[model samples]
Target: MTTSLMHTSQQNQPLISWRWLSLALLVLCIIAFASASTSWLRISPDRQLQISQLQYFLNVGISYCSWLVIAVFANWMRLRIPLFSEKHPKWLLIHCSVAALISLLHILFDTFMLGLLFSFDFNFVSAFAKKVAFWLPVEMVAYLACVVSLSLLEQHKKNLKLPESEQSYTFEQGNQVRVVDRQDIEYIEAYDNYVFVHCANERLMLKQSLSSLAAKLPDEFCRVHRSYLVNLMAVECFESHSDGQAFSRLKSGKCVPVSRRRKMAVKSSLAALHTHIH
Candidate 1:
């Protein structure tokens, strides 16, 4: 149930949705119509006579409409492979190839759409293909921007959902409740009914069970064992044994045991942080 909740939270992180896309599509339509209406002001009478009103709309606003389609792919791509990590090289190669392909397809699509606008004959409208150099670079920038925008939006959503004040604990300190920031904690240990939050230069006891506490914290706080949950950011190194047990040594000079059941998960979480693959 906790895993599913985390997965749902991730799904909601992306700001892109049907409502936003619908608004954008409406804006694109308005722009296309506005541009089509003002052709007389922008083009010379002779130039205006050369192309139909439909062709003029396609030439001016097709890229905007194309963006709506690209946004969907951007959301999918960003979710499939993280953009900012060790997978960066692979992401770049894929984006470059995909961007170039999209450029070519977009141009062809424009040319074909223009040709089929007035008649069934699709033998003409090579004019879009003529401006390949101009459109290719634009498409490259636009594609990258689309993906990056989604990534930034997701990060921003996470920040909003977990503001500094929300990412804290008000645990009992003697008789009073003492608030502590999650980032200040290096690691946590399950102390029977309560857990010990090992913070910077001090240890605070939270009157919460480890399992319940684990569900409340961020993904960075990985459960390494039944009794130990080490913050992946604080994990300096990991040592494994042939017998299946392992240990995560924190930067604060404390070694936390990694149970055999959760060993693979702990290793994977650390690897994702680029801490250690071994």
Candidate 2:
């Protein structure tokens, strides 16, 4: 599982990098369009088009630099705590607060750059207070949209790779090479540096980490514990404990302990299987 996870992660590195680049380009396009429209209306008709264009570009260029910084920070935060999958209400509040702060920083940075470029004098406190009222909502919406779009794109990519995930897995034991269908596996148990693959009335030891194996296994096989992976199809029943823990009883009558953290997932998988049957 670890190897497969690492491999998937490695494959996604380029995609992630491309996303950042695409985001920057998208921001640039938005700024350019806004700048052009605003300049056309505000600048005097007698003024040179090049001069108006240059002014607009400079203003947007300074703002874009600030936006780039904010984007990098937001992207980093998204990677660590993805907003799309976040279920806690507190995280929503935190993200809103962060978005407000980002907007404030963007205005401040733009103001600094504009002041340095064209010797303009204004009260910083009043300007910041005024801009916050106008820009906060806009920035918040943009941030949320960006996050949602990226999340959807990621989901689409994963769906596209589902067929690849369904391919059979190969395991080697000494001189014998065994090709196993993912559906035939009942459960897998981790022991030291090796994992025991339990299939129909036979158990085979493979010199691989459970995590690495789990990554390659089909979606039907779920990690119920740090040391065990249970085939949801093979799970005939679940045994619950008073301590909020659970165990999955396989078709072979072997019970696999489900960790506290995985109890809900195990239950959900079982429920899904039951639903599909009906």
TM-score result, candidate 2: 0.46
Cα lDDT of candidate 1 equals 0.68
Residue-by-residue lDDT tens digits, candidate 2, 1-278: 22111122122223457467757767886778677657756747654574447456766765565556556666554544454332444756666777778887777876564454344555667766776777778888766666666656644544554455344456555555666666678998999998887887677777789887776555567789999998888998999989887899988788999998877667755664464466
Candidates' TM-scores? Answer: 0.46, 0.46
As for candidate 2, its clashing pairs are 1-211, 1-212, 1-213, 1-215, 2-211, 2-212
Candidate 1 ranges with C-alpha deviation above 4 Å? 1-18, 30-51, 84-89, 117-128, 149-164, 168-278
The local lDDT score (0 to 100) that residue 109 gets in candidate 2 is 77
lDDT of 1 by residue, 1-278 (tens): 01111111122222446577768787878888777668745757575363577577776677766666566666655555557446455877787677778777888778777666645554453566565767888887888898888667645543454544556656555555566666678888887777777888777665667887776676678888889888888888999988876899888888999888776667655655562222
Q: How many Å off is the CA of 27 in candidate 1?
A: 6.0
Clashes of each: 0, 6
Q: What is the C-alpha lDDT of each candidate?
A: 0.68, 0.66
Question: Residue 113 error for model 1, in Å?
Answer: 2.2
